[model samples]
Target chain A: MKLLNKILFGSLSAIFLLSGYDGFSQAPDKGSLSVAINYFNDNNKIPYVLVRVKTKVNGKFKTVPGIPLKLFLNKDSAGLLIGKVVTNESGEATSFIPPSLKKEWSATIKHSFHASFMGNTKYDSTSADLTVGKAKILIDTVGRSVVATVLELKDTSWTPVKGVDVMLAVKRLGADLNINETATFATDSTGKASGDFKRDTIPGDLKGNITLVAKVVDNDQFGNLSIEKTVHWGSKFVSKANDFNERTLFATRAKAPVWLLFIALGIIIAVWTVLILLVQNILRIKKLGQEA
Target chain B: MKNSKSIASDEQIIQDLLPRKFKTSGRIWVSLLIAICLVGIYAYYRQLRYGLAVTNMRDYVSWGIYISNFVFFVAISLVGSLITAVFRLAGVKWGAPLTRIAEMIAVAAIIFASIIIIVDMGSPERFYNLFIYGRIQSPIIWDVIVITTYFFISILLLYYPLLPDIKILLRFKEKSGPGLHKFYSFLGSFWTGSHKQYLLSKKAIYALCVAIIPVAFTIHTVTSWLFATTYRPGWDSTNFGAYFIAGAFLVGAGSVVVAMYIFRTWYHLEKYITPDHFDKMGRVLVLLCLLYLYFNVNEFLTPFFKMKESEAGYLNDMFSGSFAPVFWFAIFTGILLPIIILLFKQGRKPLPMFIVGIMVVVGAWFKRYLIVTPTLLHPFMPMHDVPEMYHHYFPSWEEWAITSGSLAGAMLIITLLCRIFPIVPIQETINEHHETAK
Candidate 1:
């Protein structure tokens, strides 16, 4: 019983000491906050990059949790605010950059990102710069195998990037398989990364369109990139043109049902026949009236 | 009154009701018609040179006033079947004097109906393609079949009834000049008033009367299907067939009333088409108006009650939105006011009925416009990715010109038919008088 009381009292004292330490740490005016950005690649492209804010206290780096950070992209002439995110319990924040931003991608392949911490009275405002390099992905099929080439898009030229890691991924709809068909390879001197995929190992959607993704996620220069291609792998037709018939009732080119067509024709024929008979009857009127 | 009493003699009946030459007013009216037709032809020339882009129609409101005018013509044409076929089958003797007038309206309206539909086509040159590539499944193909059928039947109905009258007119060899006599002989030289000829004509008419009822029902029902087959909110209803047919009968009867009054006043047909005829016809119009009102309620009320998600915007626009004025005007003037005024015996007088008939016709015209345009505006998908003008539709000047020209053409046909033939059947009136005197 005494050991149990000692353990409980020790936990309460530890909580009090932690609260006291937080109070003393927040009163300092000489601390500096810096943001570190990291990206994760699932299929060659980074869906989002993570931003971590750390404070310099007593010449050491400690993560500053629950801080609001503003992310901005610096174009040549101006900086545009992308989004704002609050740091989580892990002192990390994330923002998604859309593929449309790649239109502004220059020959340098380098993007300057700034993360700023503001709107807090206790901490001095701080900002940090993050430089990221991105590479474009190209995929081509050779027989039963696939080759993924990672290239840097410069002004008026395509520069092949070498020694970069590339991954090949295949996506299927309604698939529950945990099987990994992702093949990893390094680009050769020609900046072409080659990988082989078995036809049986690949899956596809109901229409037999297999989406193949080529990815380059972890590169010191190019941060993250991916390109997806939908190919007719197993379907008999190359496009959806053969999926529906133009002679059907509910298709884009709607046609009358067979029964309806027959009925309409029957009505038309019967009416015309009766009308012709009526005309013949009218012509006979003069002769008939003379006899009556 | 004295002339009708003196029509005891067949020769006197001939003199009383033979075709008369036009007066100054008639000449002026014919000139006006020619002028309007010429203007319309010039406007159509411009349209052909350019494209449908000359009209305010866009991807959204593809059909405009041209379709509405076509519907109006078709609707008004149904009167021939109603007055001649329906009344004759029912053995109503009072309609005998009115048959020729109704038939004239029917023939003219139908001719213009065909012309207006051709005008509505973006490429009238491709009209030949309709027959070449026509799928029996298309409502348009069905329309082509039925309208052609209706046109032929209506022509025969107008012709067969006029055979005896033409023979009577041929008796006046010197009264009608060589030109008119030649035309009359060409039309009815074979129409001998023999007992066999009379019997055969009667049988033929009886057969037509019976046959036309169903065909009449089919033409309007099929016309309604052209709209009901679509998924538009205002047009998507089973009641559309009955609604269109009921409205068609109303407008057709109204036009017949207007024609009856004009002929009665101008040709001194008062002796034949008396106030009693006007009273009965006024009553018929009132009943038709009421029946049409019932169908209108069924078409709109249930939908208004539920206000289905798709129909809500269209219904609201009709009830209180941008289209409310036209909607209310069509309902009140086209239907309700006619019903209210036609209910009274004094209002059944010739002049009042004539005014009511004019109101009904004009209002029904705008009603057809509402039926076509508002529903198109409220398509199932949201209106997007179109120019601002596409979101709303108003007929361009070319459309107005063409529409007015078609109307003038129809009037010209009616006027010319009147000039060529007696407005009232002389032999039938004499036959009726002989039977009554017996």
Candidate 2:
């Protein structure tokens, strides 16, 4: 019995300790952080650089959320800070170029950007730089055809950039629709690409105006740059207004389907009516039993 | 002389079944169940404090053992409708002795069904929102409505029949402890045993019996709709409602058999809950098991035959993958083995029937687990982006404790209820004897 008790106590202690081993384990070793930044100028209206932070874990790149990223105009230093943002759930942060950096941004013909992340105890600090020579695509329309001319800013001059690919598409909320069957239009020596708009009539706003966008995406020389031109070349589209009063399954509680309300109310009435009658019967039985 | 003998037998039968005091073994059994319930309560407190994060459920397997446990409770509770409403309506005369037992199990199961569902809801505080913002078109709302209706009807059915028994207990008031005497009076003091009162009580019970059948079917069907309405590959089926109903009746009947055997053995009411009762219940269990097997074929065989690309993975997982053991075990033990055993005359004996009853119940539980988990794991879209742990599921200790607690809690209710009332109806057994003697 003594031997049995000792063995049993030993086993129980080992089990309890092993089950809570995680609570006693050492702190986790940190992984090296990978930071990358890209610049997007959509008609220069919404100019922002998105910096993404990721770390390889178990052979897959997982997003490192809550990392603070700082953007610089041309140097990885504090004085030229465009903006600062903490990474969100997707491990990416958007920092819009502030007015304070506009002077420095315009001073350099070759536009460059830098992003840096200060490390914590879990991760090593890292920085990444990207330089996309300032470029823009100009959209023009000639009878039944749309055209885009790509230009790069050199020293004091905007020269036509050759052999660069330009994609002309109809801009929408989601992905852009191709203008034609052509996959991509590579700019010729003249730095011009054009597509015909006679294939299909796309629906636009109530006024039938569509924004045609010409973009140079992931260009080796000029990064993501897009310019758009609005034209009254689309069929008028009227959005179907939401009717909260509509009665359907998917509708709100107040707008439950009429058949459903009727059936549900009917069943509830029927079942509860039986239940109520039973209650009355019980009461009558009590009254009769009292008389007895 | 015959009159004197009838009176003596009636006295003897009544004396045989008055709620007796617990022996040491009984106290120990009740204590063990109470311990389990306490552990479950503690686990629930932990769950409320830590949130669902304490559970092993994740993106891929969101509905785990909790949902399955809920289904098991709801399914097992269906036996009351089967033994009480169905048998009474069919005029199965022998069902009279077992009516209260079935009703007791049903009432406890349904009450815990409501509770276990709330336990599954992480935001049980918002339960009233189910009513205030409830949509009639949603099957969940329908389930709530029907379960509530079934609950009241079941309570009435249990109560109406027990009125006579309560009057008998009132006669022997001194035999009952002080608290129980007051409870008996509070519950049924108004039942004065008048001819008119008897007629009225019978009519009320009859009405409830008639009312409960469709509500029982609706409750189970609506529960199945909670799954069937989803377009997930395993859940998308028109046959789910009937299938769930069939399975409910089988598991419920199985539980009743187990309860019947236990009650007969413990209470020593061998004259009332006889071997003949076991044989009859075994036949009922056999029919239910066969019916469930038919529905199983309908639920799975067609899906397997078509081998639709969407269903292929789920079917393969059930047939040969990680879930294969549980799947085949449920089929063999819950359905096939019960039928095979109960089909034989010798196998319908109490001991064998009890073992088969346990097998059916245990298998049915794992079957619910299979119904819930494998489908969730085999979604139409591939499982990705989630941590590797999410791809597989095994309930954490907290989940097992709470689920086991809900089960033990149900049994505890049945136990306390048994302590309060005679396991076999004293008055009804005497009435049956009087009618036969006449």
Candidate 3:
């Protein structure tokens, strides 16, 4: 019985010491995750930012694949949370900036883009922000042609953005603000694009006012921008010197017909004649006592 | 019929029916009316300083209570022609005593109608533009012409009948204060009441009676054309002219009845304006109400059956949607209830008929309101890009003040006219009694 108790105590102490070893061995693995954003081009140019997300991990800081990251747009007033992206086999994820973001982000001069990882139990979460400059657009009308010039505004100066796609359209100016015609043009090195539409084809208001719109959309350097100009460049009213139809009665502007003039004048004359006669007759009543 | 011998002497008739100064209540009424007018002036001042934006009117609901009140004035003004011209041409003897009252209502209402339209204009300073750049083809121009012609005719109708009465009042210089005596003399001191003068005046009045009937119809018909020219659901109809004329006659007769009661009670001329007069006017109101009810059915029911895509929304709004309460109230109180009440003998009594008349007039005012605002709200294109409040409309305080002021202004004119003239014509009533006795 003494020999058996000695063996049991020794085995129990060993079992307890082994349990402590097991707890120490199971302490969570501490891994690091870091993200870098770069312009997605062959040259990988700096500062003119494109949307390329890359991640590196482990002590050697080698590229790690198959990690998911979420991209966010942060502004002074609000933040936009967007979809997740998985790293490619090269540990990089690349996407073109969406057109809707380009249009909406125009209000902010500098749009700060952020990428974050929520980190599983094995890794700590990480986040990074990148700021980009906004593009400005200007529009003008030269005769029947519409000109749109796109420039990147920095500090206090303007520089032309090349190869930007621009749109030109003519719209009617009434309540609906309907688009009549549209055409696409690409900017040159000087950031200028021009398009023309027939003035006769574009409809306008009764006084002949027409609206021309110019837009630059979905450009990487300069997002979406638009401007409009109203000009008197459409159909003019027909001469009504010899016309007297129902159109004359319904015309929004006044060009009274000869017949309407005659009728109105005739009515006025007859009524005034009766009124004058009545007045004279009333005055004649004053001579009543004289006649008596 | 009573003999001419039983009729009061001419001097007694003059004593009873001649113009008199106002009592204390009359002074209070005028003072209240003036106070209302002053408040309206202040509201109009705000409107002038701020432009039309001071009112609830926006781009969509541009015309509001002011236009409705103008239409009401024009509608009530038609009574002058009904009593003075239509009844006289038909040789209706019972209409004789009511003629002056109807004409006074017409003159007062027409003057305010013109004034209220100017108030509705965003720029009253440009009133001369109507003449300088006025398009003769426009219904507005036609309205101006007819209303002016009607104004002149109404003034003459009131004036021609008062010549002999003015002479009668002139005989009692002590009864009329010096100011009134001077005014009456200035108006009719030329009158000798000779046979030759009477013949010429009668001939002139006959000629005017013949001419005024067509002019009256034209006035109301042209007013209807102002609405009918638009393509809106409630307004675009071939039946609008007759419908408007019927309503005009109904509301006009209702106003005349109201005036009859007020004049009879205030002046104590119950013997001159007998219960027979109330009974006859009640019958007139009943017939006119039924006629208008028929037109309303034609205007609403047939369109409901068709239910065109454009008209469905407006009709539904009026029948069962947001405007339904006002719509039903106007119909039931304005047309249906008056008909039911006036059909009974007891309802034809002065007091009951007076209540019915008030119902008709009040309902007609709201009815005009419904006619204008709802059609504008249910425009062909949906209302968009406007403030949310514009999607619905209630008259702003300024609008109510201005509208109330114009109404009081009309009443003030009527009150002052009544104070200055014999509301129940003295010489005409005497001559009527003499003829009846014969």
TM-score of chain B of each: 0.98, 0.97, 0.97
lDDT (10s digit) by residue, model 3, range A237-291: 5555755543477554356666777777887788678777877887787786656
For lDDT, candidate 2 versus 3, the one ahead is 2
Better structure of 1 and 3 per TM-score: 1
What would the per-residue lDDT of candidate 1 be over residues B146-179, giving only the tens digit for each residue?
8888888888888888898998888887888899
DockQ of each: 0.22, 0.59, 0.29
Model 3, span B1-438: residue lDDT tens: 223345578777778888878789989999999999999999999999998999999877888898889889999999998988899989887888899999999999999999999999978999898888777778998898899898888899899999999988888788888899999999998899888788878888887787777788888889888889988889998998899888989999999999999899998877777888899999999999999999999999998999999989999999999999999999999999999999899999999999999999998998889889999888888766888888788888999999999999999999999888999888887887777766
Superior by lDDT: candidate 1 or candidate 2 = 2
What TM-score would every model get versus the actual structure?
Answer: 0.72, 0.79, 0.69
When candidate 2 is compared with the true two-chain complex, its DockQ is: 0.59
Q: Which stretches of candidate 1 lie over 4 Å from their true place?
A: A1-168, A171-214, A218-256, A282-292, B1-7
- What digit string (tens of lDDT, one per residue) describes model 2 on residues A161-221? 7888888888889988878888678887777988888535789889998889898888766
Chain B global fold similarity (TM-score) for predicted model 1 against the true chain B: 0.98
Candidate 2 C-alpha error for residue A258, in Å: 0.9
User: Measured with DockQ on alpha carbons, how good is candidate 3?
Assistant: 0.29
